[model samples]
Target: MKNNRGLLIVLSGPSGVGKDTILNSLLEKSQNIKLSVSATTRSPRAGEVDGDDYFFLTEKEFKTLVNDGGMLEYAEYNGNYYGTPKKAVEESRALGQDVILEIEVNGAMQIKEKSEDALFIFIMPPSRQELMRRLVDRKTEDEATINARLEVAEYEMSRAGEYDYVVVNEKLDKAVEDIQSIIDAAKCSAKRAKKFIDEVLNNA
Candidate 1:
């Protein structure tokens, strides 16, 4: 008997913390939530489909959206632009669907500034050594890149206190369950149910 608007859940974590793996698992298990697809200037990698993985755009297009104020939040990283499209998020929320935004810490902070009610969740690894192992296992980046990522991860982890919830991603299933529970609990929050409560009191 929930009558409130949908929840905006922002999930962020340091690099190599398995955020993507956890998010993919959570989406596969949950049907009530939708992923907020981001628009990026980076080229689509192999097996990455446009509109599914990302709305790949040219640099010009990305700058145009930014200038037109069409993006909810955007950031430039490694000379590429990435942003959340305002229309998709607004449309999904209007239909009472919870929107899950898997973004970076900086992007999460931007969302917080714009939408204070949004739930922010930060994922953490079991240990720094494990995180390093995970990064090396990927074999995607060079040593220098990995070192840079590690440095950035340390800084991102420092800001974990800014988030509303911190879920340790030691076990995949447990982490997914923890986030699902957080979403359920957030939906039942007093702020979300205020309208119903006020109506009941008025009628009484």
Candidate 2:
């Protein structure tokens, strides 16, 4: 059994940067890393599964959990509440499973304030033009909304320097590979490896 504790990976990126697609691919390639399912008050979108994608909750229920300290981080956006369940993440880490949080900048900042050990990664698009193109291609948002998102993306990208690593999502496969390598390297970091070293020395 590994004596080292699992890592908390907080991933954040601008909208339309393919964060979801990259995360899905990362999970498919890696084992022992679990997605931290967030709880939200918003109605499920098309094909979004409750409990799997998010723990869909009513506004009252979501607020109750937040008030009770059940959430590690919570944020309100577009009149909907979204948060990470504290217990789920704690339990997963206790079992030595790394938890990846695909969250927004606000939520990621909250996590950073709480857990200094957590690994923060910011995803970037190839260019501003490419980001705009991807947002328009989605067809889910109107022109006004797309423009709003682009403005927000520019601001979010400005915060990329705050993260531990910045990955450019030029190629899906390469991005996944890059993040996987980062995770592996993080596991071997001196801070995490020291726990195993201490255990061995004490046992000796």
Candidate 3:
């Protein structure tokens, strides 16, 4: 019955799987989609700003936000907490902008529970061997972190079956095109285009 409901797009994959890279590219090519900046207890890295990369917060502040039901979803990893703020997402939705969240498997599942109609896309590396190779190639994490992430990747990959769409990142352009098609198709869904349907019926 809603005339202009927004699309909530959730993208999830393991670390070093190029989810962030592909998301960045998609944002560049998108016209009305906005990325949801997450709030994290982790300190800002070398060049990350307070509200740009993430909404950096202290443990206490993050706990406060969680307690007050301010976050859409939250989880702790590597001794730090990360969550999506509810306000920005709602604001963007009100403006009819597509809101994209680059979160983890757990968070994606949470969103699915809350928003059954949300678009869920799981990005996959070409293969496990390629995943490991990319992890090493990035050179961003220490060996211990990389290994830990790989193990987590195994678990996350297992959950890909739960997603609405699985995009294999074998080739950059192909993957992007696949994701773009999914989004475009979602926009034309009957639920989203009810007004158009009604108009045609009334005219007839």
Better of 1 and 2 by TM-score: 1
TM-score of 1: 0.89
Consecutive 10-residue window with the lowest summed lDDT within model 3: 1-10
Considering only N, C-alpha and C atoms within 3 Å, which residue pairs clash in candidate 2? none
Q: Against the true structure, what is each candidate's TM-score? A: 0.89, 0.88, 0.85
Model 3: per-residue Cα lDDT over 148-200, one tens digit each: 99999999999999999999998888888899899989988887777878888
List, residue by residue over 79-183, the lDDT tens digit for candidate 2: 999899988898998888999999888888888888868999999999999999999988999999999998899889998998999999999999988999999
Worst 10 residues of 1 by lDDT: 1-10
- For candidate 2, give the lDDT of residue 57: 96
Ranked candidates (lDDT, high to low): 1, 2, 3
User: Candidate 2, TM-score vs. the true structure?
Assistant: 0.88
RMSD to native, candidate 1: 2.1
The CA lDDT at 191 in model 2 is 74
Shift of residue 128 alpha carbon in model 1, Å: 1.2
Ten-residue segment with the worst summed lDDT in candidate 2?
Answer: 1-10
lDDT of 1 by residue, 34-75 (tens): 999999999999999998989999999988988887787899
